[model samples]
Target: MQIDPRGPRFAAVLTSAVLAASLITDSGVLLAVQALVFALGAAGRSPYSLLFRAVVRPRLAPPAELEDARPPRFAQCVGLAFALFGLLGHLTGTAWLALAATGLALAAAFLNAAFDYCLGCEFYLLLHRARPRPGT
Candidate 1:
């Protein structure tokens, strides 16, 4: 299966944008933007594909089957958590916490990009292994 790298790239961009925007404007709004972007990705609205085509490389090789599974395993979880944390911070007007979550998200996204070792992919694999296959 082809592992689209666009999600991670968009994540990185969203994180960076939110983080930077947080520094200048309202952190809460930035966090909201990040959350919206993530939600879009999770919806599989073809936004991921568009992002991959627009920003990521065109000649990227296909990914391993195990790596191209679900879109909501680990990375999505982490992203959701981060966005939630940011929302918490936003609600409480806690700039520091929002900044922290955004920073961490950015770091994770970059790591995934550099290593192709998606923490989310690990989560999906773990779930897949734990489950009983059909007719098992």
Candidate 2:
């Protein structure tokens, strides 16, 4: 399925906010919440994305183009992976590791928010390129 290109960036803003708050507060629960959000996004049911579609998207002009969902979904999986690590590290008493992981997630979110640079999408593209094509 295709999606408005703005949708993922909008979601990234929300994700970055959550990540930044978790990093600043050192809140395991918050990180877990973000993990849940990431899981939802990976599943294509993200609350932020839903809200964007239902609320914000309706107010804006229609997008000029749409993009494939796979890249963004893959990106969400990457986010989920980081969040799981952060949560696990925090729960296991490895605060440094947790911070490191959360910080990494935060950096990625920030990139998406500030520049619309999707590392996850880039990674997805790289993987897609590396895989053998069906007819090749």
- Where is model 1 poorest over a 10-residue stretch in terms of lDDT? 64-73
Candidate 2 similarity to native, TM-score: 0.97
Estimated TM-score per prediction? 0.66, 0.97
Relative to the true structure, how large is the alpha-carbon lDDT of every model? 0.63, 0.94
- Candidate 1: tens digits of C-alpha lDDT, residues 76-125: 66676887787887788887887687767666666665665566667677
Candidate 1 C-alpha RMSD relative to the actual structure: 3.9
Clashes in each model (backbone N, CA, C under 3 Å)? 2, 0
Over 4 Å off, model 2: none
Residue-level lDDT tens digits of model 2 in 38-99 = 99999999999999999999999999999999999999999999999999899899999899
